[model samples]
Target: MDSSSPASASPPPATAETGRHAYRPKLRWQPDVEEYFAAAYGRDRFALISEALAHPSCYSCIRVNTLKSSTDAVMHKLMDIVSENGLSVGINGLDIGDQNSGSNTHEGNSMVHKCPYTGLENVIFVRGSGPHVLQYDSQPEQSVKEVIVSRKCAESVLRGAQVYVPGVLACSAHVERGDKVAVSVAVEQAVEDGGWAVDAHYEERKGLYIGQGITAMSRAGIFHVPHGIAVEMTERVYQLPSFNGTDILYAESFAS
Candidate 1:
């Protein structure tokens, strides 16, 4: 979705082109904005760009400052930390071997976590899960309270950002600080370009499911506070699987 324009209120002013090949991808972009882009850079290009933006980064890249510590040293420390964190030696172990075929351990039951790259003395690489299907209403036991954040926050959340105080547009009633809440995005379909208005109540179809988080601020604090973390996102809806270890980074230390 193009974040540069207002909510899509109407379709573009018709086009001279016709046919199925006409780049009219079902992107969440405002029709007018989509038309503008389609006008500027053909329809096909516009569709491609829209699709690319929605997907998160495929690989999690890490640049290590070798001056402070060697790559091997860091790897050993990371292995220990993950092991101590209950990854386990034989169960939830890190896949530092073949990227395509590693220990198939599901951390969240849906994700196949692993560290695919095994080289680069100064850097480490991890593979992440992708454009996988995001199950929104998977857990019914979670809190019913919800919060709607701005489109800005939605984009950031896709790139691993927590909901901040200023980004929050609305919240449910009886919400309190430190409460586990389901966080969604206030995605505007074809509303006017004036402003976004939402009541301080929960809507079943409020917005897109980004993930769940713990509220750092209460119902009042969100609108009252100017800045700070409003929700600390814990479980993401669309998670990019994390891959770290020799399996990804082919370093000398990793080889015998």
Candidate 2:
């Protein structure tokens, strides 16, 4: 017998005792606001507004930073790590290799490096270049410090950053010298919901995901000391390694 047949499809009807219903509380809106929304969007404006108000507004984008490391090198390293662990990895478009391939540059100094370990190759290097820092211009008079990472970038270090604590914010919560944390950014998106008004233009974009880091300060003493790497990155999306082992060179440079 076919299951789709009308005779075979017959099932017991739901009894009153088996039926379920949910009660929703009634909501009231101001008459003036309702009139304004009606004039602005016509029919079904309320539903549209309700949907707009509830949707997530933030989007994610990664930055390509050549100063710390080439995209190829980072991609190769990550592939090697992943492959050695017997896991498969894939990016938008790139093949995996089985051996460490020497660095190959594409388009001038910007080259792609390949690894021989996992049979994977050509993963792009992405970093959290602070949103506030504009792209560098050819002008020589520009301050190099202007291109340094932003505070928002430092916060992202909890996701992955080196053990340097000087990058922590001045007013952070109770974080110690060696605690793990997940970092996130607050982003604003424009909504057409007549539910609430937002100043889209005035909203600033200053968040970047830096990665995880180790804390360098005590939770209680952080406010008093106010200076140090509050969190050190461990694993970051952008594979910029923190040069934490250069004590001699750093001391000599400062001494001079």
Q: Residue 82's C-alpha lDDT in candidate 1?
A: 40
List candidate 2 segments past 4 Å from native: 1-149, 152-164, 170-172, 184-209, 244-256
Q: Which candidate should be chosen as best, given lDDT against the real structure?
A: 1
- lDDT of every predicted structure (CA atoms): 0.51, 0.32
lDDT of 1 by residue, 102-168 (tens): 5333321112233345664456443334333333344545435666666667666655456777677
What clash count does candidate 2 reach?
A: 36
Per-residue lDDT of model 2, residues 1-256, tens digit only:
0011011111122122211111111223477887787788884977577555432222111222346665555455444443443222223223233122332332121122332335233223322111121222224353211111233333333222342323323222444556554322222233577444222122131232233334555544533453445444444433332212322111111100
Error of 1 at 44 (Å): 8.4
RMSD of each: 11.5, 22.4
Measured by TM-score, the strongest candidate is: 1
